[model samples]
Target: MELPKGLAGVVVDQTKVSSTKNAVLTYAGYPIKELKDAPFEEVVFLLWHTRLPSADELSEFRKRLVSEMVLPEKTVQLITRITYEPQHPMSILRTTVSLLGTTNDVKRDDPPRILAKLLTAIAAIIRIRDGQPIKHAQKGWGVVENFIYLFSGQRPTPERVAMFNTVMVLHADHEFNASTFTARVVASTQADYYSCLTAAVCALKGPLHGGANERVFKMLETIRDTGQDPVQYVKDQMASGHKIMGFGHRIYKNGDPRAVILREVARKIAHETDNDSYFVLQEQIKDYMFKATHLHPNVDYYTALIYHCFDLDKQTFTMMFAACRTAGWLAHIVEQQAEGCLIRPSSEYVGETNRHYPSR
Candidate 1:
């Protein structure tokens, strides 16, 4: 029997967290188009519980998440020391997640607290690398608002908050992507939350996964700095047999729904931040790619510009991905652990299987 490589299209397990069936992304069966404008915390609650939170439940959930968005002083001191090592923020984040498990009361930490800590930790990594003191979460602010404040050290306008909230909501989950599956594989071993998250971060650090956003921004910078014609840039890149960084997806042959919504967010934020030129360059490339290859932009395409408009360095982009995705990772970890089954799979030996070992 011929098996699909990378387990593509194989249903290894069932999930209620999110889905991409028919190329439409949904959280607990609610389409992302409707949920993207919903509060980020509400979307998180939906991912975790498979239902949207009631009014009081959402309010309390928001408060709890904000309140827990603080790190232990010892953790902060340790993070400050190592975050300036000239390492990628994603590398720092990978270590910080494992450190979090050891430094805190890991056993008692629930998903709310774990998610809050990761968001705060990712924000702190960016701030410390930039030589800025970390900011505390403000009372009465929502999760996305306080997250922006923590990293940027400024209160975002309500409009900015709404836009970023959509970014977070859109990235909160995808059913059984590589990193989520890595988390679930680890969780099937009954590992702690941080371990599963750390494994997920490692998987996300690869160029093909979360790291694609940074490369997308790098391509934009190359084109803008050289003043190259945008369409020519695509032609030249493909002529050299290089894959375009942000075009195409494994599942969505038509287009990524998240990219459709994020295109507007990126447009608005880019205009606000005087980054309209980059956005223009993106449109040229997007149009050319579609006409040339029938490949549309995925979520990573516009999100690069969106993060740039927020004043984030390209290196920390995947860390931002991790922050939003921790919600989904935690949800999957819980679900996988509840099944209480170890994820062991059989494989046909593809190498020379009959070779006998020589006596040493």
Candidate 2:
């Protein structure tokens, strides 16, 4: 049999959490374009429940999630020790996530609490690495507000909160992407939530997956700092057989839907933060890439600028991705666990199968 490479176009199982069928991303049944501006907590509720929450339910859910945002004292102490190691932020994150599982009460932890702890833990990683004091989550603020304040140490304005909320929602889930698939495979083994998430983080640490956003920013900064012609820089990179990091996707050939929404957010935040020059260079490079290669930017493209505008370091970009994606990861873990199906697939053997080994 001629098998598909990397299981491309293969449907191994089903999901109710989210989908990218027909190249349009939807959570439950609601399209992402409509959900782009929805509250981050509301989108989380939808992903876990497969339906929109009632008003009272949403209010309570937000409170519950926010309430669980505090990390255990032992986890924080352990995170501080490992966070400043001379390794990539994603590597530190992988270790920290495993530590969370070890330090916390594994048996009693549920999805909401796990998700909360993951977010808070990610923020702590950022703070510790930066040598900044970790900020506490305030009681009256929503989840997004607390998250931003936790890492940034400043309360974001309403407009900024809305933009970051959209960023988180856009990244919350994509069905069967590499990291989510990794999480599902681990979950199928009846593993704990932290184990599943740690596996997902490892998969996402690859440059081709969640690490693309950081490379995108590095490329942008290189072009900007060197004052090179953006178009020529791209041509030179391509001529040398380099893959452009943020300009294409496997699923969306015409364009990434999330990129469409994020482009506006990137523009707005860039202008407000006086990073318009970076945004201008991005647009120039984007046009050249499309005219030259017929490739459109993916979600990582605009997010590079958006995170930069929020004063985030490029190295920590994938960790931010982990924070947003924990929701979908937890949701899928729950689903895969309930289904009780072990995700063990078979492989074909074609290497000299008829040959017999001689005694040696």
Candidate 3:
């Protein structure tokens, strides 16, 4: 039997996940350059439908998400009970997300409907961790605003809503990412969507992927409080071969595009909080780092500042990432399941094989 060429990056995944040369396409299939100015709801719709919704279409899409955003009273109570502990909300949230699979009775046949269910479960978990009073999803709010409202029980200002929207859009779907790949692997096993999603969240719980941003912020805070020059601080730290949290990536060799957008959002939030000085120092460090080494910032670099502005608990930061990434997780899971391919791979055996005599 011909052992087939190892499919080494042969677009084996799907036509969907492949990146087109020089095109910044969103998960939704629209060019990012165009959607950058649009509300994230539009982007979400595009991801689901593979085309941007018109004004009316977007309005209807928003209504569906708003209506679908509600979590059950039981879920609210569950999250509240977990708050009894001083453990970080993210830890609780992550645990709760895994628990969702056990309780939700996930349906496997219809992928879109399953994705919708995941959207609700993830949003509720995230909102509960943010500690906002419960609000039913019927109030005609978008996902970003709803998430904000669920956290604060108040309407997020227009600008903040836009920023949140930007965050969601940027986070919605990263192509073939670690967590996304994990979801695909699970789905390829013919498991239910919820289980695949739960697995993805579990994958994202690691610090290298979903949870690095909070640490990045903490690092910045430590350096700023020490009253030393941040450039010197970063340079010395990197010189000593200490891995800075938000500086590297497996993709986007040119730079992480999301970081550029997030930096602007961080600056905006900093201006909103009158924390411009701290933000300015951060900016100076970013400039110095980029100038000194051409390596640009990754997603976590600016999300750290966003977390600071939101007054979010540092430990819960990755939970927020998991929440936003549910969109991508669902997308990949459905794509893999629909494609109907097994994800199993083989490894070359390199172990000692003559030990059969030991069995005798």
- In candidate 2, which residue ranges exceed 4 Å CA deviation? none
81-190: candidate 3 lDDT, tens digit per residue = 77645676566666666665565545433433444444555455555655555555446666677777665566778888877777777777877777888889999998
Worst 10 residues of 1 by lDDT: 77-86
Off by over 4 Å in 3: 1-11, 17-25, 84-86, 105-132, 357-360
Ranking by TM-score: 1, 2, 3
Clashes of each: 0, 0, 0
Q: Please tell me which model should have the higher TM-score, number 1 or number 3.
A: 1
lDDT of all predictions? 0.94, 0.93, 0.70
Total residue pair clashes for candidate 3: 0
Residue-wise lDDT of candidate 2 within 103-149, one digit each (tens)? 98888798888888888998898899899998889987999999999
Name the better of 2 and 3 by lDDT.
Answer: 2
TM of each candidate vs. truth: 0.98, 0.98, 0.86
Residue-level lDDT tens digits of model 1 in 1-360: 789988888889898899999889999999999998999999999999999889999999999999999999989988887787668898899999999998878776999999999999999999999999889999899999999999999999999999999999999999999999999999999998989999999999987899999999999999999999989999999999998988999899999999999999999999989999999999999999999999999999999999999999999999999999999999999999999999999998778677789999
> Residue 86: error of model 1 in Å?
2.3
